[model samples]
Target: MAPDPLRSATTTDDTAAIGRLGAVLAARGRPGPVALGPHGPHLVTSVADTRRVLTDAEVFRFPVDVTRRATTGEHAMVARLRPEQVARGTRTFEAELSRATTGWDGGGADDAMEVLRLPVARSTTDAVLGPLETMCRDHVADLVLDWVDSLAPIIAATRPPRRWSRARREERRARTALERSLEDLRVEQPTVSAVELAAGVQVPIAAGAWLLVLLAQHPQAAAAARRHDLAVEVAWETLRLRPPTWVTARMTARSVSLERGTLPAHAVVLVSPLLLGHLPDLLPSGSAGPEVFDPQRWVGGDVRPGSWLPFGAGPHACPGRSLGLAQLTALARWAADRHVVLTEPARIDQTRGIFPSPALLRCGAVPSSPEE
Candidate 1:
């Protein structure tokens, strides 16, 4: 009914609004209908409160479409065993990631960063959507961008009718491509496939790409990530900073006092992981030094229980975290990291400009081998 913070972040005038979100989330209530309406603008803090609200599923609901409320009927049906299925799907996801990384490597040939982008997407697509009809080693960058926009238009006001129409057609093609591939998988490896898992793949893949973009920018952090026992820290760090879903929305089920202000039913709340990740006090840059890259910061503290939310805090938390972690690990282990000379990192744009991506990350690769 009102302005959508998620949508607003992509516009020209969103600078102030996005800044409001950062500030409000840094100090106010957990994001949702209540704090959003109560505070001067909308930026949600209170990770604990946000977790509480999300955990109380009966109160906060998410729908796949506009006409519905709550995870019921089709939504509930799909989510019923999502957790179990995701666990089962992980093995396959990992296997594909491994293949993507090493399938082309030879015993005596030079190994590059394995030519990232497309290969990641190719195996990712296969893992999520079933083996693609073709084994395209190259990822479709423009295709993926168009697909994301089609799902959530960056420019909401108006797209050229022809452009929108073309996107719609391409979107259908992508799904249909997956569907056809799924059919083939069923015929060959039916034991390993599940429709729900297929459906869940896109979100994580897109989120995975976002992680790549984020990690590539911060090489020092990426170096820290490389030293880890597992890449979960890397995934968590990226998520803590740049969550794929900027703001999670909820309608006030009843009157609520959010400390910042009073909120009535139907008000929307906003939550901010971006603000929470940088809480200098929570991260105390003490004798451990300036708190630059402490994975241990999340190890023993009260962080994951409620306060720190990279993959959200509660029940409706993102379920695709494991798959994301696997993908990150696969990339990390196989990485022939070229020094990250970021030409321009992603920016919070308010004008007619594109969101940040690795346009020209000019760095020499430390190829996995010496032979040419």
Candidate 2:
């Protein structure tokens, strides 16, 4: 029989492939790690094993060659943004988001992906570039967005595109443009800034977009989010349900013994936050199943919000996690009282990290008072 398009790992729709993979892994009955194919990466489904893979840098190392054009010395140049930098970025993000949504009140449908770009990009640039003039900051932000856009095809392809292919050429063009623009700014480390800005902006945009879509889809959850105290919970739930960085991979530096089996040297290991989020053992005990989107499950706080490692874990975890969460929480608060409804169903786009395709929402004011 022919392979099912949705379940085939080689299917062009990466989103379906991932969804099918998760379902298959979950169907294995126990939370044990499993190999994908004869030589494919070992998929770590259990929280314990996932954590072990992420934390044990010695055994499982990051595949630095994730992309075709790998750079050296970049890691040495990158540093986490200071507290003050995060604060500045948060302020900028809130302000930019407000500006972007000014006319959204009861307005026609707006594409969440399109509307979220400026806020995320500008805020990331502010945090990384640090104290740039307004005009210069916006220019750099635009360049960063352009570069990120150009990288989609290159990053999504199963195999690296030919160096001279249009995808590669476009990616190079985008990267060069952003790098040159950053260099002109005389930033402390232009290359580092470029990397930081791209990493910071792209993920947050996908996350914020997902948050909006979830809120729109779950009216009860959206209503609960109106309470300032519940806004963070709403953000957590969004990440739980639809984390943008759903699946990540690490390479085994040497043979490692797992609870289920031993992986040989130079094997690839996969950890999926999306799959882990579905595990009942890892979530708060509740009447609603793990598949349900109930933010109230976290009210008692018995279980932590990040057990599934939405932003990842250990040293290599996302540096902008705090800022990313803050941005999502702010978006949740903004969406709380609004009657935001999806214009159509959102299909997952897995080209570069999973994101909602055409996450279009129509916004209107909710009733001020409940009807008697």
Candidate 3:
């Protein structure tokens, strides 16, 4: 059978490529751990198996030096921060969204991803670094985005490149720029490091873009977002379908048992939240389309949301998840008020985390009830 075009861009070397490989593994129907690619890195296909690997952080510890060694995991910082911090961050995000969308006249063409860049960046920067002069905040946001872009090639490479490679050099330069920009803040907030701030900033930018892309593609979902208090559901639905960080890896500390086989110690283990999201049993039964975008499915409350672990699960799950959802929700409201339509097909770019490149969207004000 032909590959499912909905889940892919039909590109030979993109996230679709990885999705195709995942499909093969999923077809095996709970087959024991199997190699994800040529040399090694066995994949854990089932949710139960994936959860076991993530939860047992001791055995599958995060590879902190991922540039030099294999690695993948979510944040530890989210758990460390106080609730008030998160609340303050959400407020910052709302303010930033309004500031970012100011010039969007509701009748012009703009790349949805591009539109989100400033607001998401500014919001996250404010949340992480606290109040800053407008110029400094904008400059810092731009640097954070540049650093994120620079890390792409390093991440997408099958194996870590040599220390002096061009990709590594670019990543280092970008990282230095971002760190230098944050140096003053580092001194002020001794406990909050620059690395944590960058992670907190970057992921939401991508995830927020993905949410807009999903809404633009699915009109019903988009309409629901505009007409109701469903940003949380919309955010969850978007994450379910196209989580930016679709793939994460862990190295086994010891031999681990699978349904069909045993993965020896020090083996590379792969898990995909995208694949888990597609499992029939995990989603609502009467939703008519499990694979299609349907935010309403979340309204019934029959099934638990986020079983797919969009932000991740266990101890290593994303710390900024709640805030990330709030940021997306804020954007969703902005998007909801506008009649946003895709100007071009949004292609999946997986050089870094999965995101919609060229997510061009045109926006017009949604008719008010009186206008309607």
Q: Using lDDT, give the best candidate's number.
A: 2
Tens digit of lDDT per residue, candidate 1, span 1-372?
113222332344645335444444435323332333434233445555656555655555453232111434123222233444434445444555556545333322221222343444444444444433454312332244334444443223253234346655655565455445456545343222233333234445444544454444545555555555436655665455445455555655666665355665555555555555555544433413222334334544543522456566555565555555556555445443433333443344322112233222343454343321
Comparing 1 with 2 on lDDT, the higher-scoring candidate is 2
lDDT values, one for every candidate: 0.44, 0.77, 0.70
After superposing candidate 3, which stretches have Cα over 4 Å from the reference?
Answer: 1-5, 8-29, 63-80, 131-136, 187-192, 367-372
TM-score per candidate, in order?
0.60, 0.89, 0.85
Please list the residue runs of candidate 2 whose C-alpha ends up more than 4 Å from where it truly belongs after superposition.
1-29, 64-77, 368-372
Candidate 2 similarity to native, TM-score: 0.89
Q: What lDDT does model 1 reach?
A: 0.44
Residue 68: error of model 1 in Å? Answer: 11
**What is the lDDT ranking, best to worst?**
2, 3, 1
Q: List model 3 lDDT by residue over 1-372, tens digit each.
A: 122334543344445545544453354445647685675677777878888888887788675453444445443343544566667777877887777667765656677667776777777777666667778878888887887677777777877888899998998898787777677656453223455656676677778877777766666657766677787788888787777777787888888786567888888887888777878778887763556777778887678988878878887777677778778777777777776677777777766667777777776766554123
Model 3's TM-score against the true structure: 0.85
Order of candidate numbers by TM-score, starting with the best = 2, 3, 1
Better of 2 and 3 by TM-score: 2
